[model samples]
Target: MPGPKSNLIDLEILDGMPDGIALVRVDGSIIHMNAALRHMCGVPDEPGEPLKLESLAVPDNIAQWRRFFTHAAEDGGPMSFDATISRASDKFTFYAEVSFHRKSLHGEPVIVATIRNMSRHRKIEEALRLEESRLEALLRLNQMTGEPINRICDFALEEAVRLTGSRIGYLAFYDEEQEKLTMHAWSAQGVKECRISNRTIEYPIKNTGLWGEAVRQRRPVITNDYNAPSPYKKGLPPGHVRLERHMNVPIMDDGRIVVVAGVGNKPEPYDIRDVRELVLLMEGMWRLLQRKQSEDQLKMSLAEKEVLLKEIHHRVKNNLQIVSSLISLQSEVATPENMTAAFKESQDRIRSMAMIHERLYRARDLAKVDFGEYLRNLTSYLKSSYQPRTAEVQIDVQNIMLDIDRAIPCGLIVNELVSNAFKYAFPDGRRGTLEISMRKDENGILLVVADDGPGLPPGIDVSNTPTLGLQLVHALVGQLDGELALHREKGARFEIRFK
Candidate 1:
């Protein structure tokens, strides 16, 4: 039953308002429908239009609408609910928000409903959800730091396929200069279903077909119709996954394509948005690859340095054992005077070798030693060793540098020459000067050690000298592949020059 004549609503104002307006009675019957509501419900606002709103509900929702209207009438003040109404042409449907109020029109009260289609709004919400998932996928990929490159690429491919609504995907690493690529990662399911026997298919871009056009054109390529005839089409190899639709996006770094991210057989055609999403993921993957490579290189460099340090330790241990053997032999000297001198000489030699290793151990660069510093330490030690005689002996030396191989021999030579001068140069409480100087000359390095107190006996062959100190000086000079000269001017002096 419709509302009374006096209960009619003035719907002319609402007709132009872009919303569906309708008036109903308390018994689930229609009193009036404006043009918008009429067009929305597949009903005409004319003579013999259906009086009952239930007449417009589809068969499955008829009882649902019956209860909905009954409840709204009982509330009688204001109410709103979501609904789907069939279109006037019955071709499709529209989702809408239906609201109604109890209002007095003229004298009697009726229900007024306003219907606004929510189809577009629902679509916008869905689009936002899709974009959110895409961003979430990228974030998940980025958070996989320290993971292996292949594993990260696999995850990226999976997300690319999933977010782009595709059945399969692949990420291929590109050689930008060579225009070549090797398939590196495939969607786990995509690889399982493929029939191709050669998984190591490295394709040159020039020889590739539709899929390679992305690199060729340096842009994203979409093939909505994969089977269409085209000049760039290359027939698929046997066991290759069939493609109904496909898209490829090239990830560029420094203006060169470094990776090509491709997805195929999407149920729906791909678009620019898919290109953008794939580019984001692949670019992130490229950064991960770069980081992994740098980390690997650093690991390799550290490993090499570790090996070098181990070798240096081994050499030092061997040399220290040799010095230990020499000290053991010195313990066997027969006479007390000779034994004391022999032990002192052996100890000085040990100290000299030990000092070089100590410097190497403490040095920032293990490859070389500051020979100047080594000389100063040696002279100070020699002066301390021959104490009680005098603290008045003056030592002057030059600055020099040499690597471990040459520095060791030079150190031993300095130890012997400087010790001999301190022991025998000054006699009878005489205080004198010992001068040691080194310089780079045209021939090589010129090392001179001289003391003004005394000179060696004439006609003695210095090269074949029987004394251990002079023998060591001659041997060390030979080790350096150099010439040694004895000078008798003013006092005893030795000049050793080596390259």
Candidate 2:
């Protein structure tokens, strides 16, 4: 029921719209069309000419358009559908979205439709979704640090095949040390002839094929038609599956090709996007492999160094034992009492040092020694050295570990103090007991060497004593950064504390 003015305004608005507009009679015959629609249909805007929907639609879509018009008339509501329109050139088709509405214009029943091309928009949306998937795959690859290389390659191949719609794919790693390429993992879906059963495959030394071309070029290569004749063409071997289309991506490390990933037999031609995605995943996996290799080399070097250090300790202990034997021979020839005592003391000191190396050779950690075990052995040796003596030696030391710098000084101090007690504390061969105890407390380590014998003489100060043994003890205590005290209560007692 629109007036003349209103109808004119509606026609003007329809002609100016970006989308194509057309009006058809209920019988499916075109009554009027805007300039956009006339351009889409590729016909002149004649006033009285016969134009039908069937003439504009592609032959395959003619039936679909008939069904759509029937449904729109029956439903009498706004309806939308997708269809292809034949272009005037007849060389290409246009994908479009068409919306239909039943309207009454100038007392005539007609179908109004607006058509918009959707091909470009569809491509844009698909690209966006593809980019999102690529980013997610990259993130998953980054989180796979410390995983085995085979597992990483398997994951990468699976994603590549899925994204590229490929029938089969594989990842191969190059060993620079060995100068060869080994296939680590492969993925095959719905491919019966090319199914891979082996865990790994070693390429021939003189590799000649599409894969070799990628390595030689040091870049990505895509072949839409593998069967085409060319100089780079190398046919598949016997029992090998056929390849229709293929893409190869090489991963580089320090200007050398370290890995190559390839996909084959896609339903369509492979494009740049496929190459980009595969390269991204392969590059990440290559970095992880490099890091793992470096770590393995470092561990091997450390093991070699440890073996060398243990051998050095063993030889040093043997050399010290030889020195101790020389001192014993010299003491046997000495007739003077003072000379014999001096030789004996020197022998004991050398043996004490030799014991430290012996313990180190036996220990799992070469840097520290079990001081308690060392003291036990030292006390036994001292008792044997003072043969025919009636004094009994007792040890009550805790199991503590000390480094070489502290253990050597501590061992010498114990030797000097205990030897003095056995020699002078009990005169006339009187029976007595020498006690040695060492413990660690919050303050520091405490060492006590005491004897149940005649105590030191009155007014005798150990700090100022002129005896070599006492002076040596004072000097060792100072080197340890410790405090020393002498207690004369029915026995001689010396205590020292240090960290």
Query: Where does the lowest 10-residue lDDT sum fall in candidate 2?
Result: 1-10
Which 10-residue span in candidate 1 carries the lowest summed lDDT? Answer: 1-10
lDDT (Cα, tens digit) per residue for candidate 1, span 1-499: 1335633335556667688777776666677777777777767556374567666555666667766666667777677777777665664776778776777666656777788889999879867987898778777777777788888889888988887889999888899877799888889778888998876569998889888998889999999999888888979889989889989988888898888899999887888878877887778778877877888777876785687688877777878776876666556553676776787788788888989989876865566788887888777777787762642544455566788889988988988887888777777777777888888767789888888867777776779976667877888899899999998887789999999
- TM-score per candidate, chains pooled: 0.53, 0.53
Instruction: Spell out the clash pairs found in candidate 1.
Output: 42-88
The C-alpha lDDT values of all candidates are 0.78, 0.78
The root-mean-square deviation over C-alpha atoms between each candidate and the true structure, in angstroms, is 13.2, 18.4
**Candidate 2 C-alpha error for residue 39, in Å:** 6.3
